[model samples]
Target chain A: METTTMIGQLPEVTYAGVIIKAIIILAVISAVAGFGTYVERKVLAFMQRRLGPMHVGPFGLLQIAADGIKLFTKEDIVPQHANRFIFMVAPVITAATAFIALAGVPVFPDFVIPQEVPLLGGIFVPSIASDVNVGILIVIGMMAAGLYGPLLAGMAQANKWGIIGAARTAIQFLSYEVVTGLSILAPIMIVGSLSFVEFNNYQGEHEVWLVFYQPVAFVLFLIAGFAETNRTPFDLLEHEAEIISGYATEYSGMRWGMFFIGEYANMITISVIASMVFLGGYNDLWIFPAALMIVLKIAFFFFLMLWVRASWPHIRPDQLMWLCWKVLMPIGVINMLITGIAVMLVLE
Target chain B: MENFLAQITTIEGFAFYLFSALTIVLFWITVMSKNVLYAMTALASGMVLISGFFFILGADFLGVVQLIVYVGAVMALYSFAMMFFDATRNIKENNTNSAIVFVLGGLSALALVLIFAAPIHNESIQALYPMHEGVGNAQDVGIILFTKYLIPFEVAAVMLLVAMIAGIILAGKKMDNSLTESMDEDVEDEIMKRKDLK
Candidate 1:
């Protein structure tokens, strides 16, 4: 079946190549996620007129390494009343789902390893690990599944704050999921394919970013993405002021670090999706190459998320729910309906 | 073991067996576990594993929908509700009628077997929407859903809408009243305030 499926593809990607690519994605994304925290701290500090982590090493360039060492060396602690098994499993769920979601997202353009690269030479590595036809949906699905990490972590810890965090996690993630799906439906309808590659190619071929056509969707997706990732203005899940770090109150050492990594990874995933789906993906600009273009777009989104985080204040839970169900969801549905009619007219 | 392993040549075959085995084990744990939290977690994971079966069969759209709908939304809601209850404690089950339970279980098992076996033996049973060549699985499913099975699809949508409305009405019947506060005191205060205003 695998062979049959790959018969007509432009390049026949090998299993070995996919495995290698998956490994590369895992290592690179994990490293990038760690680096993201450093960048976020630096950016947030700059915004607040503070010099953050300058004493660590060269303006805190090696702060990631320092943090990594600290996390690794710190004692793993579980609350006395916590469910030990689920507590241990929760962070893995978060980290694993975050990485798995990246499987369907194209981080880079497809390229073949040169013949001189020894054993891995002449291998064709596709942009995505698995470019299943329903790529976007599956990526979204995996991210939605990532809610379990926080939900389970908070519930298992047996702390009041953790339970509150878990409760917030449930409502926040579930509510935004509707907005995310509905908002993205416009672009999916326009492109007529769920594959990120297809969305990229469609924009490239038309010489127009999807954001230009579906600006409302682009904005809605960004807001929902922020909430889904539990960023500021919607970071009620772990709102320190009210709940004392929310679901992560009982987590210590690398378990807590795993949640942090998962969050940063999810941020990157959302940035990548926004870039690919709305901002013309990895397509080459007039002066820039495809690779450089995609990196810049993704970087802008990552910085934008941090910028929003630095600037915005958190919303109340009731307000968040009201904004989602009564505001964003309705707008998304209307936008999708309009886009459907427009597409039908154009096609006809 | 070697022969069984050798029979699984494709990645799909290997994944099928792996997911099926894990799904069964997880579901078994879900059913047998005394703790509500543990049961819920196992059930959620089992749902996720079930999506693997769909993916293995090349039904990518169904796999994703299963993930999004079941594991992502439904199970998360289940866990959310589990928060209100003391989920960590073991649930003690009192089986009052083992004989009736066994008979009902056996009957359901027999019905399930018959339902599955019918497809194998029946020659006249045809798929309503045959898989279209050169079309993606998602597009194929969409075409069938919007065309041949449109009525059934609309009916299902309507059913879901009705269920959602009913759920809202049932859950929101006493939204204005605080469960923690005394209703009689509030009512008496309101009556006194009204009398004073008059």
Candidate 2:
């Protein structure tokens, strides 16, 4: 069950660190995602020069815990006219897909689900849960694949507001997904492979974070990241101004909270992605006390999301689409084309 | 036999079946579905799912290209075309022409059963070169395509370029044959006049 115990059992299997590692990752991310909510609220409050979570047990650590308890106990109301089956499955699917990504995310270089110990061969073959070399692509790809949920959820709800929310979400997500992808091209171009493990090593040697190479891309990604998360300036899909309440407006209790939690969880995942792609994930040199590099890197972006939330006001839906499609997309195309050329030149 | 069977029923196998079934089912429904809009959606799903199958088969480049080219580009083109045409609920039909649909369906089902039931002979397994040390088949596949098939690749590029140009021209404002001919003639005349000026 523990790391050392498994290590003890298979001395011959040098790469036997895989199985129990999955458990640790699962536990760590869930706790992080749950606690991340409390961290964001507390950090945001403090940043606004306000006290936060002082009343809760020990600096508001129990704040997120209490919210979880509340959701669990709250009476779930299935909308009278809503498609019951899909409505139930929608939130569950959203939560599960968000969790599904942590499986392939490499916390440490060598940590993975255990390898097949072919006793004859003593090669310490390193691997993740699923090492397709296109591990990062699969994560992004699967993330895009789950967009059907919101779209279906909207239509299935059979409510006018739900349809508006769903349509806005679908358009918002797909358009920004393009920018999210193009922003990544610069990193992939530099790294010369799609493997995340290799990407980590690539950043380690690049002497600077990816933002240094691609500043425009970093900004572009930040905006697109906001769009993808359905946050402010890009959060017009759930707009209170124009649309009546917006998608999942009818959803009550935990069902609604699943979407709420899922959205925030996505923000964290995007932060993790940005960290991985640009901010040198787990690679804070000197500025951070050596022990807390990963923690600091994650925490910085978690704060960055809050900063954007507090600092920026929401944009109109038309403007949101225009910014992504017009301003970001062309720059993204050029970034990709330029990166591709650079990679080819370097390879040659 | 057991190993092959195991491989066929695993996640990889299920994906193969799932995507293959997706391609066929949606495609069949696209043909048979009463609603034209619904049929179009099905066709798009079929193409996308087929590309997904390509992905599961480790045809990564092909799969992504399939999605980008077919589902993304071609389907968009299809829907744009569909939008221009009138397809309302009035077009919905039960136009089966008696029991032929049933007979054909039964025949297809029987064919599928026979196909899966067919036995395999591993005649080439003993001769299969063992997984050995080298750049592997990916490199070989690449090398052969680029080197040996370089001429075809270049030719294909040229053809694709021509097709793309033609697509742009045709997808623009609709023109009669006479208008298209006159435009071509006018362009030729301009080219000649420019040559004279030079």
Candidate 3:
């Protein structure tokens, strides 16, 4: 039932390789998240028929660096009435959980370090940091735990707007989590494996993406992903027009930047998961290299997020809940049931 | 770098100690913190640390489920409900009888720990089946849960469903009472008009 023959053919796993991969993932993903903000600005600007961030370097390429510097140098302010300890810890939780969720995600294909390297020679790096068998479940769990950051931050700040924002954050996150889990259940049932690598391998072998098999699940997952990341339309938690900056109203400087980093990191994580589960993952398509193909897919999802944000207006809080419980969740459950029956019938 | 990697390669007693220490500290904070919100946050962190323990034990399925159910869903709901109350008020533990009860509770807990420790020290427990070589973390758990523990699992699921329905009914009852209270004021006004005519 379980085949390790394929994994056995791969390079050996080593502690050095795992550590190196972790560092690489952290640094590269962080940089990409910064770059994502720039891309978002550019995309939104193009959509709006205006130039965006032209001052910093060529076509505002260095704007992220400038923003980083500004955020670092800006004054860190704690509101007079706020719970200082929890307030300070809140953003860190958001940022940490977001990155931790990436631990289960396979950002790129595995590679072996050359023996020619001086200190760390002949080490094999797996695509994911920790390739736990329950990879998708752990990732989803970590992401869900991230809700505490905004929820606690908003309430601790002692601002009326912050409380309102926190309330919305709690409801929005909890409601959509159901949709995300149920939507992904069908694909998990189809593959009979929760590990992303297995899902990728299944698709690679069958030459058919799970999305082609379960299109409804794919759409539901995508919509739920948007809500989970608190992207536009579903981003009522921090909608500037409604609740000022929402949970981040009182946050300043690097603290505020942490929230943005967490958001972008989560966006990347969702894209990676979607591509791995629904798209062909790191599997080669046509003449494209597997590694490059996955990156391209992730990039497309990220761009789609920014494009949707620019094009659509934010939904009301009630509407967001209505959509989650009444619309998406029911469809997701039905999809899962159908997929389960189909799988059983095929097996029989 | 090689030394660092080598150090991490072995899961030493130090890692266990570290996680245990973290769990204890967070649990203490959860119990002792005056602010309810802080206590709740500490509780959530403690739950995550307990999940860490489960992960160390190679129960990946249980650990992830612990995070999802306890730390993620339950704690989020707790904090959401907590927001409706005033956090500024420091809950005063002024009851003398409560202090006596606390001491008794502490003694009982100590006694219970000692009782459990003796058996653990004496007994050498072995797994019914070796868990190291398995199909997958989730699959292994699913197999046992659906086969050996099927009845218990079904009972738990049914219990959860009943609890969910009860919660909804309770909330509905509150809403109905509020609506009736508003209508009652109008009914009282009509009765007063009749009394004036009499």
Best by DockQ: 1
lDDT of 2 at B172: 56
lDDT of each residue in B1-198, candidate 2, tens digit only: 797688678868877877777778888889777654556667766876886776575655455456555654465446445433333332546566658978898999999988876645434435233223323233445566798799999999999999978986986556334576888999999999999999
How many Å off is the CA of B63 in candidate 2?
Answer: 6.8
Query: Which candidate, 2 or 3, would have the higher DockQ against the true structure?
Result: 3
Predicted structure with the largest lDDT when compared to the true one = 1
Q: Write the per-residue lDDT of candidate 1 for residues B109-133, one digit (tens) a residue.
A: 8999898998887789877677776
lDDT of 1 by residue, A147-182 (tens): 999998988888889999999999999999999999
TM-score of chain A, model number 3: 0.96
> Candidate 1: which docking quality band?
medium
Give the clashing pairs for model 2: A18-A112, A18-A113, A18-A114, A19-A114
Arrange candidates by lDDT, descending. 1, 3, 2
Question: In candidate 1, which residue pairs get closer than 3 Å at backbone N, Cα or C atoms, i.e. clash?
Answer: none
Model 2 lDDT per residue over A1-348, tens place: 011211233332233344445555557666777777787787778778887777768887778878888878888877676656566766765666565555445554443233464542333322354444455665565455445456545655657777777677667777887888888878877876666656666677776788888887888888888887777767877788777657777777787777776676677667767777787755548667523765567678777887787778888777777788789999999988887887789789
Clashing pairs in 3: none
Error of 1 at B179 (Å): 8.0
| Cand. 2 TM to true fold | 0.70
